[model samples]
Target: MSGADFIDARAQGRHDWARTLGTVALTVAGVAVVLVPTRLLVLPWLQANGADMPEPLRSGLLALMAGLIFTGAMAGLFLGVRLLHGRSVRSLVTTAPRLRWGQTLLGFGLSGLLVGGLGWLLDPGAVKPLAEVDPRILGFSAMAMLVGFSIQAPAEEVVFRGYLLQVARRVFRSGAAAVVLSVALFTLAHLGYGLESALFSLTSAIGLTVCVLLLGGLEFAMGAHVANNLVVAFLFQDLSDANAPSAAGVDWTELAANIVVMGVLVATAAVLARRRVSP
Candidate 1:
């Protein structure tokens, strides 16, 4: 199979209208359920305990707790895929029978190198210390971020690229149609980001989707997605409200740089996949 080929032999009878629509409903419901902890459970706790902390620390606390809760989305995704689509979780995960650990790591490391390198080169020293965080809090928060983003990003890929793309391709009966609609839906989900931020996200969605399609699975894309989020979030931790990562105005130059990074990332993944497959 070549990088451009993505029709999984395992998903033959899976993607009908009902299941596709159900995936959306279930995915959204899953997110809403997961938010319960962050909004209802963690918010009060953080507010009560972190009253004296700097905005960044409180924000970090919110993310830490939320990350733990966000694992629900992955569960919900699997459940919906099973109940609604009558398919195994593996259908939405990889073209292969099981997950590919090596590709996942490759995607994570390569995308991180490109994105973090470009970001630092273009806007050096953009991040500043949010506050004089306690050593314990800082250490814990770092781990929390890794845990949270790891689950959060992959869960998102399962819903967006995995579930959505597969269903759309089945429904529309065109790879182009599936790709465009999936990318469009992903872009629309980030309407809160405004035009520039939406554009940035759109570009990113395309890149990650390309990575998934090329690698014939979600492992690499999930890893790339997580790495992308990590660089953007951590480097800019103190620059903006954690609650609103896009609250800070988007800069055109930064947007341009991000697009380039995403584009290069996609291209690199394609090249890497081709080399491994044919050579």
Candidate 2:
């Protein structure tokens, strides 16, 4: 199915304006509830005790905590889709009977190669070596990242490319408009990171949205997001480190590289999707 076909599938369920608005409101409340208490109560405790932990472990724990908060949002989305919209959560994922796992895995492999390879090629010093860290600590941190990002990335795709995209398509009645609105909202959500970060996010959102429309599902976008986060977090120097370059800093070379990578990934997805449907 194409993007229009995917959106048209919404007609199979109760996709009235009231239900769509309710889902959005409920999802926002769910995220706020998770974030507020965690920031107020849990983060301080972690900060106080985090000094005793190894640096890698401390960072990993923080990532895990942040990722876990999205569980509430995912729950709210699922509930809203099932109860309010009277549809299965699968409807938010794909028009097919089952998710195309091959596409998901392919997306991960291709994105991991492109991002990691181009990142190292563009700035060799940015890539971290595994041998620099203690083996045990590295192992634990890797595990934390794997679990945390696995949850976090897919949950995000579910919200933006999945639910929000469908809702936008229904409301706007135009695929191009829906894509633009979804990408804009996705970039806005990351604006706190700074203008440079938001620009990269805008590039990423456009590529991911293109993949969703071309491939007609969330799987590829979900996999690509997970790979992008994992590669950046594990291989590249820590962006969150106090000593690292400011997120606000503009590097034209890096920005250009990001655009190139996103363009290539979208093209790759388009080719693969076409091949799948070809005789």
Candidate 3:
């Protein structure tokens, strides 16, 4: 089903905790498998393949942690959707009719320009290095990043806004509380992003929660998330310096623009969702 259809279904009533919990449990199981590496045979095989014990083991641990989070989120979201017949939770497995190309481009363009502009003004020294990587390595790196993000983003959306927020909404009977919890969980999930990105992720998380409340469903968040990953993976070449040093205070210009644009979008979406869901 399409994202719009999923949202419409979820808006009908409340979500079910039992199905949601089942989903969470299954996801947890999956994460455990990835993290713990059950069979004694598995470690020997990895060692034979030249997998760095310390690095691969460390990476696997981190991956396991991240995978667990996404798994829980996915389970919760789908459980809610299944229970509510798509009424109380959105579907991350679905896609919407393409947003108007112009509108989508405009949104992305504006956000990038604002962020880049702010970087230029507040941290001029941080202009990214002219990417000098070998073409093959660059291609491979891009592919790897794309694959990682593709698997991760939907999993995250389903868990955070789709399942957890939906369940919270049922409990609180308030949109704001659910959004807050979702944002907090989302921030916690980014613990692997390091201190700076985690901090920015929290800010971004708040922005996203507001986006959800205003925009009415997970679709918008998914789009924004994809757009962000695409930029980091394809457009900007460096991963090491993703967060360059910045000026002491927030960039008012970029911050203001982001607030205004997102605020307007959210307000419009919330109004529309209200109209659709209300009698």
Candidate 4:
């Protein structure tokens, strides 16, 4: 089936305004359930006692907690799909009976290569060397980042590109409308980072949405998102550092590079999709 047809067929039946609203509400509550307690209780406790802990250990713990919020979101989405929509969680991932791991891996490798290479070429100093890190803490921090982003990235994809996109397409009965709405929402989700950051997110969301429509699945988008974040976090920035600079703005050059990288990713997805359909 075509990607649009797959989305339409998957979203067919059982989708109504009420269920859609319920799913969104549940997702919010799910995030809150993890976020609220972490902010009010866990964070305070960590601040009080974390000073004595090793920096790497403390940072890893924080990453773990942050990652758990997405766990809650995924949980809520699965429950809502099962109960309200009477569909399996797998339906949100792909039209196929099983996930296309090869596509996902290809996306991860390609995006990581493009983003990491671009960042390195732009500012070689930005790349953190593993040898410079404290060997004792390196394993802990690396593992924590891997685990955290593994959940965090895929959860965002499941929520935005998978559920939201499919439902929006069904409701609007226009793939274009669905892509625009989902891209807007996705961009808004990053607005707190600043206009430049939001614009970058807009570019990324558009590319990812295109991947979903072309490949008829979330696997490629999920992998690409994960790789992009990992490349930024592990190489360019220290996520364990609370005082690390936010993505407030980027220079024109960086913005141009981001656009190019996104374009390449979308083009790659298009090529792959074409091959899949070709005899």
lDDT for every model?
A: 0.71, 0.80, 0.51, 0.80
Candidate 2 segments whose C-alpha is farther than 4 A from its true place = 49-55, 237-248
**Candidate 3 ranges beyond 4 A from true positions:** 1-17, 35-117, 120-130, 191-198, 233-279
lDDT of 4 by residue, 1-279 (tens): 457865774654488889878877888889899999889988898889887765455656666786898998888888887788777788788887788998889888988999999999999987776676687787887688778878988898888888888888878989888888989999998665456677788888888888888888889888888888777776776554534335655577788888898888889988988988999
Cα RMSD to the true fold for all candidates: 3.0, 2.4, 7.2, 2.6
Q: Could you tell me every candidate's TM-score relative to the true structure? A: 0.85, 0.91, 0.60, 0.89
- In model 2, the Cα lDDT at residue 65 comes to 75
Per-residue lDDT over 1-279 for candidate 2, one digit per residue giving the tens place of the 0 to 100 score: 776777555475677889988888888777888989998988898878877765566667766875878887887888888889888898788877898898888878888898898899999987776677899999998788778778888898888888888888778888788888889999988765456778888999998888888887888888888888877787874524623446558777888988887898789888977987999
Model 4 TM-score, all chains together: 0.89
Candidate 1, lDDT over the whole model:
0.71
Measured on C-alpha atoms, candidate 4 has an lDDT of 0.80
How many angstroms is residue 190 displaced in model 3 relative to the true structure, after the best TM-score fit? 2.3
Candidates 1 and 3 compared by lDDT, better number: 1
Among all windows of ten consecutive residues in candidate 4, which has the lowest summed lDDT?
238-247
lDDT for each residue of candidate 3 in 78-128, tens digit (9 for 90 to 100): 554555434423233222333334433433454455455544565566554
Task: Say which candidate scores most in TM-score.
Answer: 2
Worst 10 residues of 3 by lDDT: 53-62
Clashing pairs in 2: none
Which residue pairs in candidate 4 have backbone atoms (N, alpha carbon, C) closer than 3 angstroms, thus clashing? none
Task: State in Å the error of residue 220, model 2.
Answer: 0.9
